[model samples]
Structures are given as structure tokens and as C-alpha cells.
Target chain A: MAPLIGVVEFPGTNCERDVAHVLEILGGRAEILWHGESSVKGADAIVIPGGFAHGDYLRAGAIARFSPVMTAVAEFARGGGPVLGICNGFQVLTEAGLLPGALHKNSGLRFLCQEVALEVVGTDNIIGSRLEPGRVLHIPINHFEGSYVCSHDTLRNITESGQIVLRYVDNPNGSVGSIAAVANIEGNVVGMMPHPERASDVLLGSTDGIDVLGSLIDCLAGDTEPTPVDQGH
Target chain B: MRFDVKVEVRPRAGIADPEGATVGKALRALGFEGVGDSTTVHVGKLIEFDLEAPDVPTARDRVDAMCHTLLTNPVIEDYSFEVIPADSGSGD
Candidate 1:
């Protein structure tokens, strides 16, 4: 059976179809789960795609964290299921306490939409399992509030625990440690600001994103154990 | 009893407030001599809502919960609220 991936949709979410399309192209079944619904329908994996949920009012993802479906999503993540949050979804994960750190407005106070380079820093998580450390990939980021921030103590903890999964090559948003993505302590839940789904196709100017998404699919196929690319850090 | 609540939410101290800094820059650019270079600005949200509660204590408790749960994000923001009788005059 094809692995089923559930794409959650909030009121202002506009990336559900894009995510669903990409999953289907990757030979995985995708389902759109409405925010008003309380269940995830037994999905093999879940992807919370990017978009301006709740019009991004009161901060991005702040309002959407209370959606009925989020309860189930949290439950699914707590049970060790693979959950990927992209862009605004990343904000939602932090707002929901699934991930650490908070996303503030970009340091430049302007909306940034362009291709940015990312360095895979850790492969102990499901998202980076198939990629090599120090490898750079170009992915598009579009958001006004995408600067990740956390306390010094939290930063030290994340670094020591190998929870820092990806880092920005150029540090466009002034995130602490130039962090671009992170995984929860359990490593099953990952949240990133770049749109991997948008870059999965060759015609989209790059296919580098496929490796990340492919690793997710691989994890869903019962290959989720940590594969440390390099133990010297 | 009907009570009016005004909630003010702002980014916690030590966190960079880009929006507020932009506004401060704009103010300085407009030739506002009173705006000093050392001035720091913090931008936030003000939400006003009216609800029925038994008394002032209950209204404060409910509004505090509302702020914690939805009105403000505890991770990046701090919030405070003022509860008053709905029919009270604006002067008070």
C-alpha cells in the first residue's frame, strides 16, 4: 500500500494542493485534512504546508494552533509519527509547542521571497537522513515573520542535542545561529522555513528538495532510525 | 455583569522588534527632532472585547486565561489587561 500523507488545511492555507500534488508525484497518497475536523484519519505521515493561516493576524500561526485538527496532529507527533511543518507551518509548530523557538519579523522588516541556500547540519532526523552534512541546497523562502529566536540556554541545548537540522548559508533572516530548520527532541517532528515541496521538481529550477522529501517518504516506509552522517561535531 | 477588557500584547524585553524599529526610523526620517537616536520603540497589539462575567475577579481571571491561550503568545509576547464595567465612561 502506498504511504498516505495527510496535508492539513487551515482557513487561510493555500498550499494544501501544492503539497498534495508533490506527494502524489512522489508515489505517496495525499489527503487534505480540514482544520475544523478533529481527526487525522490514520495517516502514515503528515505535512503542514506553508501559507498565511488566519490571515497571519495576531502573529503567524498563533490563531491556527487552536484549530481542532491541531489537537490530533499534536497527538500524532507525540506518538512518534513523522510530521513535517513548512514555512508558516513551522511557525505553527512553534506556537503549538511542538518545536522550540519563536519566529519574529525579519530583521529587515520586509517581506522576503526568493531562493535561499541552506546547509544540512544534522541527519539524525527523518528529514535529513538521506542527505549529507555540510551539503548546500537552494530552496525558496517567502515570509515576513520568519526570523527564528530562542534563549541562549535553549540554543545551547539544541546544539548539544543535535536538534539543529539545517542552517542558512547566507543568514538572510538573522535567525539565531542562522538556524533554518530544527527537529524536536524525539526527531520525528521537523519544522523548516523553506518550501521543499516547491523545489521538488526539476522544472522548478532545482530538484535538491527531492532528497529531503524523499527521506521523509523513506522514513514512512519503516526506515526512520537515525543514520548519523558524521559523529564528529 | 458585562465587562469591557482591553488587552495589550507586546514582544518580551530583549527580543528584537523589527516593526517598532522601522516605525522609529520613519519617525526620525520625518524630521521629528524630539525622537532621539537612543529611543527604543516597541510595537504591539491592543485588543478590546466585552464579555459577561459574575464580578471583577471573575472577569480578570477569564481575561487572563484568554490572553494566555489566544490573545498573546507566551513564548514571544507578554500581555496585560484592564477590566472595567461596560457602561463606564471613557474618562475613567
Candidate 2:
């Protein structure tokens, strides 16, 4: 049986289908889990896909963080289950305290949508474990508040602890340290600005996303689980 | 008793404030006095809410929790608050 992946969709989340399609194609079964769901429906992994949750009214990911589904995501992460949050989903993760730091406005104060080259920096994560370190991958980023912000202490900790997973080659959005993705201390949960779903197929212009998503699929399928030392930290 | 609460949120010092910078630039372009390249500005949020609490201290504490939990992201922002009885003035 294909590992079931839960794709969480808040009211304004528009990428659930896209993410689900990609997951299904990647050898995982995807189930669209609504924000109101109190449980993750017994899925093996959870994904919070990109979109303007709650219209981004209070702030990106602010209101959505309060949704009941987040409770399950938090529990799953705590239990060492894999969880991935992309784009606005990343915003929601930080808002819910599942991930450190916050996503602020692009330093240029403009919405950005473009392809960016991401250099794999931390392989201690589910998504990064499948890729070679220092490898650059082409992925598309679409967001307004994708710049990562954290205190100096948080930066130092994540840097020393290998919590940073991906970085933009050109520092496109003024993210601190050019960080494009971050993982939790346990390395079970990761939040990334780039949309790996959008880069899943070569027909979509790039297959680099396969390496990212494929890494997670490998973990879900029981093909890979690296010890802390093997994570290459 | 009901209290009217106002919470102000701002990015912490040293954090980038591009929105505030853009506003500052606009002000300078409009020829506002005392505004210059060195004039540092940071835009923040003002959130007002009505709370039910027994007393002033209780109301303040509740608002503080709200700021910590939702109104602000402590990792990147700081917040302050003002509280008044809901009926103290005309908000109707």
C-alpha cells in the first residue's frame, strides 16, 4: 500500500490539490485534510501546502494556525512523524510555534513569483536527506512574506544545530542568511518557501523538486531513516 | 465588566522594516520637515478589542496573553497595550 500523505487545506489554501497530485504521482496516496479535522485521518505524513490562509488578514498564517487541524500536525511532529509546510504553510508553522522564526514581507516590499536556485545546506532533514549536500536545485517561489526573520540567537542556534535546510543561491527575498527552508530541532518538521510540488515534473520545467519530495517519499515508504550522525550534521 | 483594549505591535529593533521605510521615503518625497535619509521609522500594528474581565489588571493580563499568542510574533515583533472600560467613552 502507498503511504497515505495528508494534505491540509485551510479556508484559503489553494494548493492542496496541486500538492496532492504531486504526492500521488510520487508513490504516496494523498488525502485532503480539512482545517476543521481534529485528526490527521491516520495518514503517515502531513503536508500544509501553500495559500493565503484566512485571507492573510491578521497576517499570513495567523488565523489558520488556530484551526483544529494544527493540533494534529503539532502532535504528529512531536511524535517524530514527518511534516512539511510549504510557502504560506511555512508561515502557519512559525505562527503555531512548530517552527522557529517568522516570515516577514519581502525586503523589496513587493510580491515575488519566480524560479530560484536553492543550495541544499542541511541534510539532517527528511526532505534534505535524499539530496547531496551543497547541490543546487531549481525551484519556483511565489510569495510576498517569504523572508525569514529570527533573532540572532535563534539564527546561531539553528546554524550550529543544522536546522537550516535550504538557502537561495542569490538571496532573492532578503531572507536572513538566504534561508529558504528550516527544520525543527527534532528535524521531523520542515518549512520551506519554495514549492516542490510545482517543480515535481519535467513537463512543469524542472524535476529538481523530485529530489526534495522524493526524499520525503523515501522516508514515508520506509526506505530511509538516518541516525543523527548519518544526517551529516 | 467589559474593557476596551488596544494593543500595538511593531517589529523589534534591528529587524528590517521595508514597509516603514517605504512610508518614510514617501514622507520625505512629500517634503515633510525633519525627515531625512537618516530618519529611521518602523510601522507597527494597532489592534483594539473588547474583553470581559473583573478589573483593570485582569483585563491587562488577558490582553498581554493575546499579544503573546496571536496579536504579535514575539520572534520578530514587540507589543504594548492600553486598556479602558468599554463604556468609558463613545465607541458606538
Candidate 3:
């Protein structure tokens, strides 16, 4: 059966349709779930695409964290469901505490819009399984607060545990060690600053993001590869 | 009442925060290299205030409330304030 992927949409969120469209192109039936919804009833996986939820009034994702939909996403992730967060969605994940660290403003204090090169570092998660370490992929990023920061010890642990799935090649946000993406301890959830959904098709620019999303489809299809965690330094 | 308020802002981690790093480099260039060991130096604005209130505690409480609701982004920033008596216009 084709995977039923749900995309959550908040009031200020603008990327829901784009993500949903991408999922359809990738052979999955994508549905947009309103933020007030309580459950992922028919979702095999979920994607929280990028957007300025809540006008970024309270530290980007802070306000959106309290939305009713998050509770459902949290529960879904806890149940071993695959979840992916891109850009603002990444911010929301951190705000919801589904993932660690927070996405803060760009160090330059400017809203950045450009394609970034990311190096895959962890593959245990569904998003990482399709790409090899050192492989460079290009994805567009449009955000003011995209920095990923955490305590030194937590950063160390994330690195040691192979949870740092993506790293910006140019260190765009001054994130600790250019960490662009990370997965939860269970590897079922991932939050990344680059927008993979935006680049799934060649007409959009780069198809590198397809590999990342394709991994999700593979995961839903029960392509159970024992992608063991790598303690990459 | 006199209240002391400070606004602290730091760059989010792993961002190519050129502004913060530039400032750090500027500090080192100015011979304050000891500041290195640090990439970002948080910037803050201190707002001291004197408010006429029934009591010092009341003034402090009001000021603290103002800070959270208006003075800073509580999600990304933390703040603290102290209240003291404001001296009358000293023209001596």
C-alpha cells in the first residue's frame, strides 16, 4: 500500500501544500492535517514542512509548539512512526522538545534565502538511509532563525551517537559544528533546517532532496535495513 | 523606585553568524584577544527606571511584568531586574 503521509498546517505555515505535493510526486498519498486536529488517524508517516508558524512572534517555533497537533505528532513519533521536520518545522520540533537544540536567528541578523550544501553524517534514521556520508546535497533555506544550538555536552553526545544527520557545508548558521539536522534518540524523528520538500524535483533545481524523502517511502514500505548508529566524530 | 533591566541576546548555535564572529574578531584585533575562547558575545541593553509606586516590591513586580510582556522574547531570552530608590533631581 502507498504510504499515507500527513502534513500538518498551522495558521502561519505556508509550506504544507508544497510538501504535500512533493509526497504525491514521490508515490505517497499526502494529506494536510490542520493544527487543531487531534490524531494522525491514517498517517503512516508525517512531515512538518517549513513556514513561519505564529508569525515567529515568540522565538520562531515557541508559539506553535503549544498547538493541539503537536501532541498528536509527539504521540505518533513515540509509537515508532517516521516524522520529518524541515526548516521552520525543524524549529517547531525543537520547541516541542521532540528534538534537542533550538533554531535561533541567523548570526548575520538577515533573512537568508539560498541553496545550501549539506553533508550526510548519520544514516540510522529514515532520512539518512538514502544518502551516504560525505555525499553533498543542495537544498534551499529561507529563514532568519535557523541556528541550531545546544549545550556543549549535548552537542558532544549528539555527535557521538550519530544523531547529527546533516551538516551545512559552509556552516551557514554558525550552528555548533555546522549541524543542520538531527534525529531523536529513537531515530524515528528528524528535524532539519534545509527544505528537502522544496527540491524533490529537478524542475525545482536539485533532486538531491529526493534521496532523503525517498528513504521515508522505503521505510514505510518496510525496507527494514538495520542502519545501526555510527559514532561519527 | 529604581529598576534595573538588561536585555541579553546571543546568536543561535551552528548558524554562520558572521556578525557575532566579526565582533569577536574586532575585539581580538583591538588587542582584547582574551575574548576569543568565545565566538559570540551576547549583547544586552540595561534600562534603569524610577517609578513612583506604593512600595518598592510593587514597583519591582510591575517592572518585571513589563519586561516579560514587552521587554524581551521570553522564549529565547531571560531577564532579571532590581528595584532601588531613585534619587531626586540632584542639582547640588
Provide fnat values for all models in the order shown. 0.64, 0.91, 0.27
lDDT of 1 by residue, B1-92 (tens): 89988999988877888878778888888888777542378789899988899899999999988887877777678888899898778686
Tell me candidate 2's interface RMSD. Answer: 0.7
Sort by DockQ, top down from the best: 2, 1, 3
Candidate 3 lDDT, A1-233, residue by residue in tens:
57788998988999999888767777777899888998986798989888888897747777887789889999988888999998988988888888888776677777889999998899999787678998999998888888777777788988899899999999876677899999998899999988887777778898887788878877876733333221111
Please write out the lDDT profile of model 3 over residues B1-92, one tens digit for every residue: 44333433443343344566666777878897458544555544466545677677788678777765555543345566666555545564
In candidate 2, list every pair of residues with a backbone clash. none
TM-score per candidate? 0.93, 0.93, 0.75
- In the range A63-137, model 2's lDDT, one tens digit per residue, is 998999999888988999999999999999999999999999999988999999999989888897578879999
Clashing residue pairs in candidate 1, if any? none
lDDT of 1 at A168: 97
The runs of at least 3 residues in candidate 1 whose Cα sits more than 4 Å from the true structure, single-residue gaps closed, are: A223-233, B36-39, B88-92
After superposing candidate 3, which stretches have Cα over 4 Å from the reference? A223-233, B1-76, B81-92
Which of the two candidates, 2 or 3, achieves a greater lDDT against the reference?
2
Give candidate 3's root-mean-square deviation (CA, Å).
Answer: 7.1
Q: What TM-score does prediction 2 earn?
A: 0.93
CAPRI quality level assigned to candidate 2 from its DockQ score: high
Query: Model 1's lDDT to the true fold?
Result: 0.87
Encode model 1's per-residue lDDT on A37-109: one tens digit a residue. 8889989898998999889888899899999999999999999989999999999999999999989889888
